[model samples]
Target: MRVGRELTIGTLSRRSGVNIETIRYYERIGLLPAPPRSQGGHRLYSGEHLERLVFIRRGRELGFTLDEIRDLLGLMVGKHTCGEVQTMALAHLDDIRAKIADLRRMERMLAATIARCQGGGRSECPILDALAGG
Candidate 1:
């Protein structure tokens, strides 16, 4: 869809599901380039802004850090081959696998703690005890 004319930060936020403050934060962190402002100093966003914001949000949803998203954006700006993108994706997949492994370990630990709870009262909750390193 053609996002015509200039869009205010609020409009961009609504359209992209990214918070207005987050857009500013991304600009501050260089993840998103600062856009031109209006005569009254209001930020003016265009279709490109919407597209890039969607890309950033999608990357974040896929478990990429801001730094990694920045790198991916940079790579996207160049004429990279499919092989290069595939390699980067494979690396990200490995990272996702590692995170899944860690989460599984945490789940197992939590399950064991829950199993240990005597279920008599809140004061004796094993989950709380485990969190307290007991």
Candidate 2:
């Protein structure tokens, strides 16, 4: 979509790939600002709002939490340095790496448990036994 057009909520949703409900939720949560209303009480979002929504969607797609996005947005609105942004990003990267490590550990444990299962139908399943803490 072109960047200069004023948009309704629906149009902003389509343009930013965020749903209307999510847009309202973001507004409520202060991630997004409440847009002006038309004379008919319809929301009138600006291109700037559309851009901010797009930034939020992209941040979510990248797995940043809303708080992190809020901080980033705060930094962006201030006269902050790239060093500040990099510090936040590096901390987030460490969190992602830790989560990946934990998932890998879980994968190994699950695979080992499943591998120990001998496939006889009668009753004695190792998977179920393991899950039951036996």
Candidate 3:
């Protein structure tokens, strides 16, 4: 559908790949504006809702927290400069890089533990010994 056209909540959920409850939660958190309700009290979402929901879902998949997504959405609405959005994205990138570094450290620790236990019996298992605080 075209932007600005009305759609049912189900349609929006399907199109956006976001759950119906999540859509409601976004509305409650002010990340998304509450759409107009139909005569039957059902939510009638418009194209703008679809666009915003897509943005939210994509941001979530990229590891952004709801608060970060909110800031990005605010920037979009306010027509802020691209530099501001880039700054937020760069911060998120740094966070992801740090997590990768932590995971690499964990991998090294696990590998060392495995190496220490290779061909060892249960009584000599350094992995379990380490876990047991030995």
lDDT of 2: 0.92
lDDT of 2 by residue, 3-79 (tens): 66669989899889999999999999999999889899999899889989999999999899999999999999999
Q: What are the Cα lDDT values of the candidates?
A: 0.89, 0.92, 0.90
What residue pairs are clashing in model 3?
Answer: none
Candidate with better lDDT, 1 vs 2:
2
Error of 1 at 22 (Å): 0.3
Estimate, for each residue in 1-134, the C-alpha lDDT of model 1 and write its tens digit.
56878888999999999999999999999888899998999899998898999899999999988988998898899988878878888999998999999999999998888889889746777788788888
- Number of backbone collisions per candidate, in order? 0, 0, 0
> Candidate 1 at residue 89, lDDT?
85
Best by lDDT: 2
Model 1 lDDT on a 0 to 1 scale: 0.89
lDDT of 1 at 107: 93
Q: Counting only residues 3 or more apart in sequence or on different chains, how many pairs clash (N, Cα, C under 3 Å) in candidate 2?
A: 0
Q: What is the lDDT of residue 13 in candidate 3?
A: 93
- Using TM-score as the measure, which candidate wins? 2
Of models 2 and 3, which has the larger lDDT?
2
